[model samples]
Target chain A: MHTFADPLRYASRMAPTKTAVIDGNESIDFAELHRRCRLLAGGLLALGLDKGDRVAILASNGQR
Target chain B: MGVPAAGLVVVPLNTRHAVTELKYALEDSQTKVLLIDRDPGELADCVNHVILIPDAYDAMLSAAQERELGVDVRESDLAGLFYTGGTTGKSRGVMLSHRNLIANAFHYMTTVPQREDDLMLVMAPLFHAAGSNGVIANISGHWEPRSHWPRSIPRSHSI
Candidate 1:
């Protein structure tokens, strides 16, 4: 039953304020990172995108 | 990350590929949405929606509400379509399920147990499977914060 999002949810609950991801000087806490992910997910859904839809992310690894 | 998190399949296009190759991958994958970090040129026309990173990307995130979609995502569901190097012919899309990726992360973690304080620097282009999979493995196992080292590592080190 464990999905990709489960670990973040668990980590956020376990340590919400802990730094979950960092890229250079920018750092996001577990709770904030989880919230942003949800927001991004929501944004994609708002665009009429649903499950099984193809999304291509072209970017280098960074805070963005 | 947002793609799969939204229960959608991701196609990480290799930036190094020629424009024609990029176009072929997009067309073959039937990508609905394309999020590019830079100008995609004629390739943008291939997808239904193309969002330029930073500017349009930030706007999209800001405009949308912060909520999690309630979707039943199965492990067997296709999570990504990774294209292989077209050494013999045109690159082919490799269908990978959520279980496939998760299993890989677990396997990677078992091989290299990550510590919470360890810092992982992603130098490799994420479009490649190894790069993305390594990042996934690190994050899934431990919340090891990423660091961007300005100085490149010596050539003696392969990684």
Candidate 2:
């Protein structure tokens, strides 16, 4: 099965440094965003929490 | 992959809420581990765990590596529950599935004009269906999506 990270990796490899997200004065490149998604994915894995175990996120628009 | 792999159901909480309201949502949702955007002192008294937003969250995701989530996922299994405001002053859980989401994504794309070079400005809050769906569309379409937060959007050549 394909992981959620696939599309992220595809974007990064296809566009590399292309700006993926821009929030007001802040911006994140595709590569950095992919890394962030991966890291987040990793962090969720590290929690020792089961895959389907629910994690609630309450951040505003930018954080997602 | 985060919540998708989770047989664990995820419920996004509303930040603009009172302790009691937040407590009710947590308890009703049966959130065993609570991850908050920021530390809510009041929530600490209710939830067993409270995760601070931004830095702490970024670190979690950044440091997160691919590991087995150890849960069985099925096509018909409930993916998430979207609560809607009701006449009884309570909300109803709208059971949604992975296929429901993926199918809807494909259906919506058929109606919308998506170009590889399109850069979408998502001005809605993440909690809204439109906003959340927009994120999904942007991701699936491989188009650059900008979030309007705090405010302001800049001009771009190719988004």
Candidate 3:
């Protein structure tokens, strides 16, 4: 049983350098991914969106 | 509604579709913002704020050093609007909530031991449950998500 609200954090602290994500041509370590998630979440928040506000992303699934 | 839709309402769109069809969905849903894989100017009839996923999205990620949204989500909030095939000639909207998605995701996670090294490939478009859920679940599990299938897989193997 994991003991954290953000399981991602658990992984990060457990293995910061472990390769976490491999998207076809690129890969990101857990530490790197955590940073990206935070940054993107920040960008979303900067767009004047509140917690429950709807924000639609139409990307076809690469890494955006 | 699934992990991606938790705490938010997502409307999936077909990337292969004509702009006119996309416009109708946008209008019907009153979508505040529309994100597109490509150019949105292909559809001229309707107008709304459009954000095109840029080539630099990855570059931005590489340089990302900030964090914001926490994982806390309410079970009762509206999560997503899944439109059905519309047997009656009009597409129907299926509303899903955060709890619905979280339950499903937890169930899925328990069933599969998605490895930290494994890359989850989303073969379908990013609109449906499989694509959306897989993407977010992969993120939560710390697994890499392959955007393009055969092309991406081979590249990963090479590395």
> Would you list the C-alpha lDDT of every candidate in the order shown?
0.76, 0.59, 0.55
Measured on C-alpha atoms, candidate 3 has an lDDT of 0.55
Tell me the DockQ of each model, to 2 decimals. 0.57, 0.46, 0.36
After TM-score superposition, the amount by which residue A14's alpha carbon in candidate 3 deviates from its true location, in angstroms, is 4.1
- State the lDDT at A53 in candidate 3: 54
Report the TM-score for the A-chain of model 1: 0.91
Instruction: Give a tens-digit lDDT track for model 1, residues B1-159.
Output: 656867888999887788898889888888989988888889889998999888988888888897663268777888899988899999999999877887777666656656778777788778888887877776666542222111232313334
Interface RMSD score of candidate 3: 5.2
Tens-place lDDT digits, model 1, residues A1-64: 5456765666677778987678878898878877887888888888898688888877776655
> On a 0 to 1 TM-score scale, where does candidate 3 land against the true structure?
0.68
Model 2 per-residue lDDT at A28: 82
Error of 2 at B153 (Å): 32
Model 2: per-residue lDDT, tens digit, A18-40?
87778889888777766665555
Superposed on all Cα atoms, the candidates' RMSDs to the truth, in angstroms, are 7.3, 8.2, 9.1
Models ranked on lDDT? 1, 2, 3
- The C-alpha TM-scores of every prediction are 0.87, 0.73, 0.68
Fnat of each candidate? 0.66, 0.52, 0.40
lDDT tens digits by residue: candidate 2, B1-159 = 246544455666666656666667666666556666665766666555566776666566655665433135665666565555434876555666665654455444545778776788988766555666666657655532333111222222243
